[model samples]
Target chain A: MTEERRPFVSARTVAERAGVSRSAVSRTFTDGASVSEETRRKVLEAAGELGYHVNHLARGLRERSNIVCLVVADMTTPIRARLIDVLTRKLQAAGKVTMVINTGTDEQSVASAMRQTLNYRADATVFLSGTPSAKLIETSLANGQQVVLINRDDPLTGCHNLGVDNEMAGREAFFLLRRAGCTRLALVTSTAHTASLIERERVFVAVAEAAGLPVAVMAAGPTTYASGYESARRLFGRSDGPDGVFCVTDLLALGFMDAARHEFGLTLPDQLCLVGFDDIEEGAWESYKLTTFAQPFAEMGDHVVDLLAAPVPVIPGRRIFQPVPIWRKSIRASAL
Target chain B: MTEERRPFVSARTVAERAGVSRSAVSRTFTDGASVSEETRRKVLEAAGELGYHVNHLARGLRERSNIVCLVVADMTTPIRARLIDVLTRKLQAAGKVTMVINTGTDEQSVASAMRQTLNYRADATVFLSGTPSAKLIETSLANGQQVVLINRDDPLTGCHNLGVDNEMAGREAFFLLRRAGCTRLALVTSTAHTASLIERERVFVAVAEAAGLPVAVMAAGPTTYASGYESARRLFGRSDGPDGVFCVTDLLALGFMDAARHEFGLTLPDQLCLVGFDDIEEGAWESYKLTTFAQPFAEMGDHVVDLLAAPVPVIPGRRIFQPVPIWRKSIRASAL
Candidate 1:
């Protein structure tokens, strides 16, 4: 770990090798800095030979580091993985490097992630998952870091909020199932109870009960495919099982569909109808054809980058996006 | 964009507020640095009030950045996403931050990503996808950055190479299909001629042809589900379609299976047999149940971190890992 283990080639070495001034070598590497084309070529060639690279860490200390931190958890999950991909690509195109702080689902991890975001002095910190304390958010704001929260309902000040319209999507799911003549309704969710999941479950249950329908709910485990499969086993083991189901996520829906078809011998849309949230790519496979709501990842990614690239700190406020429904064979066509 | 927009709190502010020397504030934040307990407590409280965050960028300029760059493409793919998830979690546990450079399958993007890795002076760079030129590798090595290439066969010096035994897996897949009494065999791959996919296709075709079995090869599009579905459609459209198919990836196999069952009305094992590479989580879903080879992500992640954490730079060499076969129900039990 000693500094002498690896000797860093400096601009002085490149300048000496190219027979140019140190300022000429620096100008060649710095964007928008003026240097004659002939001198730039010579400097670059020398730098290539000497393995001299402009130190962005030093530059970042003098100015704003074009680094964006994504605080996330369960990054292997379909939806979260897609989110990170879109965000990182979009941010890179906007001249920002993404530093992912994987905060496992725990309060201590969330705090540690926030601390890392501050330690790096990133230009912005995007909370893709896990809720940070208000105190942490305030500290980040005071350190001049722009904060953005995704799919979270917390009303922390001085931070931009972006979320999907889960309530609307959930209500629509209930109406879609009921219109298809489904009498027995059930909701399959997970123990995570994230803000988006809670919102979806609440609206679906409220709408169903308001229409004088009893809705069964199951949250046996975390939001994963296996949990959904277990929930299906428990729910459909009875003679009077639900005819229609609403799953909080596409992964859960796929698992539920598999268990119902293979174990319970129920055919989709004929013996049982299903709808899911988050139109993950898996749901669109020929095997599933799951009818669900699409979270606009591309649009959300663009919006987040725009907020970060703004010249001045834009007024902090919530930006709610509507999730569009994708019609597929998982639900009865009559419901459409 | 102006500096006046957000005022960053400094250690001086905390020191002034706590009536302590500026060095005391620094000592309190620096890990393992000594300060009186009373001064440490007072400094922390004052720092919390003033929101002072130590800048790692400045510290990085003096020594190592503790940043590991992951140059990758197609990060949203199941196996790649899982790889990143495992690598990031392990690296973070070892006190390193991950910087993902998303190099879209293009030469220019790959070159740009390499330049960024050098600019940041990352302690190590792991190439997860898209091969880099030998000239780039040489430059990185000269610049004192440890480099690791995954699933590549390039004989570049001064860089560590890690890859799966794709040849063995492909050979085993052919024998498994043959033992299951599948006379006609096919290999389903993608247009993206990555080293792993090419190796898998090569060994499978060579083994089958050596056994006097003619093999059909179809690489319709990119390595995706849609391409797999299209491959299956074209393969099974003929009257004498292959009964056993070996897909280069699980995603393609799943698509092929769905198309065979739904489009061609073929039953599993009875009418068709399948094997695939990369035992992604989705392959084990109740629907697909794909028999495939596991990439050993956790072990590889651990190895990458261990290489980076070495006090002295370890000698650069190649490390080949064997892919373990996962026997799922996609193949007939008679193959056992």
Candidate 2:
């Protein structure tokens, strides 16, 4: 549908003017294809005179448009920045030119992003770490463009969803802290809630209650370094502060660790235990040595590309990946 | 030249079919222009029937192109990531769609990026950090595109250059550490050198030598957290370890601080005083409270836009910003 609309100059016109066969013109343009210099020169001269420009989109007109749109909201976040770089490299290696759109997670911004995608006539769109409005997804599906949502669990029909198992990760974190001999457990999160963070917190609380362990919850202003630091002070201000804490994100966990050590002078693992999710690169720094659940970035990139290459009319499908626990020095060594 | 090559639909054709003046057709497309509803309806109908797609470039063929190309080499660096985000927002607000080209500092990649800028017929191009090859800059200048380089000091003729005053920043950092009663000093930097880091290091060495204070320099790998941690250990391995240290970047400083405290059991400010460049957010955490220099991101973004909007044949200009020192708990509190 997108390709047929472009104005193109047929190769036949160049061949006729150059006084050569159509196959000869193709040979001239094809790399490593044998074509006499004289014939190639004539074809090139004629094509240039006729203003014949190559339409890369026309070659894949029947099956694909060779263009992918990457939609992301926050590029400053460490994980999102890493994902964008990796995904862009992978898509470029696959011979697809990526068109990135930075949009807020609001309904109006998502609608605008969808309009931009339609204007570019993209063959596929990847929503990275934000819930795009359902209407936009349906509209994209209706236009024959595949839509893949990352780190989201939307049940929209005809869309592909991929995310880490946040519930299972939360349960594992609780058990690990408990086994490490932490009696008082707490959870820290930000106000600008993402679905994945919400799920991680909800499941963690549920598991602690099921085990009959008391829990405390603290809400930070935003998932930023400053917010986490301030929230940690508030948590430690209590007379009976929790000994074990799980932060919904690594940025928050880093803040909590710093405050616990520098401000409160608490000994880690011996006096307190910490766990974080989305194991960013900074988490492994010798200072933090944060124990976190590592999300599979390489696998996610491959899955997105594979889904796009699949035949159209893809039914709504869900693929969940188990998060791997990366134990470092943040938690005490424990045997199950 | 690019506009002449594109297939365009003239307003004359729409005017003739709608039986209206060509000026009326122009007024219909112009925003907030007073055109009768009946005439607008007729003009739009004629345009739709004739398949007339509005060419924004054609409208400004004599002056500017609505496209701006942003060429960056490193996307993972926190400061660069923040700059890209802020620049994109500012460009979008000014009604220009940015075309981002991620390239390496190598000659081949830089040349390829220049070709892409020419293909898009961008009005201007902004180089974030890496030094663009001289040939590419000259070629872009010849093609009538304005070129701006950030964090660079190359005397490239007819190219605008903007950077922070690294010499002054380095000198100030040296004095601040000295006032904290530090007798021995050291500087930590990465192997993958940038011009800004080089300038900072050069100035610090010059100042210390003039003050008759010996300085030690340690090089790290890639300026990552791990590299900083390793470099700190190497600095401590010697019996003559320095009491004060300055890292060329904030990321490295964070790592060094963490290692000094967590691994070496050294108390900050009492055992060692630290300063960093590019005051990143993580530096302000309660654990680090690093004293560092802050780059002016918002001002730089505005300056780039202003330079691009300047009249062509713009005489090359140089703009330098002063780096502000943000003091925190990383150093001893001073009345001054």
Candidate 3:
């Protein structure tokens, strides 16, 4: 490679240029290391002239890399994108760099992502999605890397589990819809069957069943806007359709609302009432104004960073955050 | 760290356990290194059992890190998010990890992000946003690192510049609105005068001036939804507002449309015509069928990866991709 042909500027070069010892140059670069102000100025000036950057890779071998790996699937999704943005900014504030591993909804890819975390010797790994193998978790723990799982009930030992209360949100959605004076009930979900989605679906269905209300559950396709649109078509195509619907995601809810309005000529709250999970920014748009459960992105990010910043290996435990209820025009005022 | 208390499993341990030489263990772990199949299998088994991961940081000191740094600002913005998603997925497929440096629209952050690139010895650094200093570019080139600037007109030597044809898109927007028989014209932009935004605004204003048409420009705040909404309120709040509006971004256009429709009670295409840049996914939503110019995200990502994969340093030049026009309900039929 052409890079190899050029000699890499080392601390020795900086030291000679600054007329200082190699150790002084090293101390000047090392974080929190003590160095005289005069020596630091000299070293920095010389280093700047020589284009000498501290080899963080080599330093990482001795100490922590301060790199955190985020293993995520479907990163382009609105909710996921928002979550990543929050986590990355929070981690950066904590003096850690984020390495995003896009494992596209596959177990094998998730395993590979975990392997990369170990390869880089990342200080921590946060799983925003995908189910990693138990063996990989064990390997990560053995290598001194903290593993944090979000919105997953994997019951894996030696990892922090942080998730929203999906069951509570689901139950609340049913109650909110019922309070809107809707008789027929339905649930719009996707075939993804992720832990959080499944939990929300199961609880909502159980709540409606206990109240002697018939509920139609549809998993038309993957958790996407198209799937929600398809679900609306199938459900509302019938003469007797749901008057109250609870969607597992904001994307799905928005799609269902559009198809219901434009295709079926149904007005929200009058002909149909809808509740969605994950209060994404689009949900608050003047057009959609979707009433949904808001995931505590900032709070969750703070918790993760706090765990990583701990001086000692943190006690691995479950930290369930409550999803805040965001009321908009999608649901009737009576529900509030 | 508790990790230091536990002895790190070394290659010697793996070699002894596998009944192979140290060189065999090393070769088995190193990519493209020659090792017998049986020896490789034995080494892997021993390494897996012992939970020994190859220190990629140390390996990167000798070889390339295979890390690509992406310096961006406002990553949560729809267009930036879409671009990042495409780039990360593509880079991962090419066996490189993505390090996103969120440089928050500040010059200092851009410099720090470049330093991080040098510290990690990334194979390449792509500036998705922010204008890095010429001195940093020279240092990066001197260190044999490929620098690729996107959507920036900075003629820094030794760096590849790839961007969309903002001038063409801006001019096309004007003519499209003119074809719709809208005499009065205005441009909805933001206070964040990035290179692309400035170019689009400049060209659009120049084109209108050349046509002897008065153009109203409003930059109430940053390039954001709220800013767009505020701009629309300010523009429409006036009685003699322009009927034809060109928004520099889809986000701005969506917000402008929402405010015009809900607040000002303006009907689209009949009372007003709108054009936007960046055909983000949200722009295609049923509520906001926004006419926009589509940025070639996939093509740009392919070009970046190809540049990084070149065997030798590529000749630094500009590659401008044409933005494709997306017809939607926001523009009049005559415009099509």
Q: Which candidate has the highest lDDT of all? A: 1
Give one digit per residue, the lDDT tens place, for model 3 in B122-167.
8789998898889889888888788999898877877999989999
What TM-score does chain A of each model score against the native chain A? 0.95, 0.86, 0.96
lDDT of 1 by residue, A193-274 (tens): 6888999999999999999999999998998999999999999987799999999999999999999999999998998999
Residue B22 lDDT in model 1?
A: 91
Q: List the residue pairs that clash in candidate 2.
A: none
Candidate 3 residue spans exceeding 4 A from truth: A1-7, A31-41, B1-8, B31-38
Clashing residue pairs in candidate 1 are A311-B1
lDDT of 1 by residue, B20-118 (tens): 999999999888999999999999999877877887887787788899999999888998888899989999999999998887767888889998998
Q: Is candidate 1 or candidate 2 better by TM-score?
A: 1
| Fraction of native contacts under 8 Å reproduced by each candidate | 0.72, 0.21, 0.59
Per-residue lDDT of B216 in model 3? 96
True contacts kept of 3: 0.59
**Model 2 stretches with alpha carbons more than 4 Å out:** A1-36, A39-67, A309-316, B1-35, B39-65, B309-315
lDDT of 2 at A72: 80
Query: How many angstroms is residue B57 displaced in model 1 relative to the true structure, after the best TM-score fit?
Result: 1.0
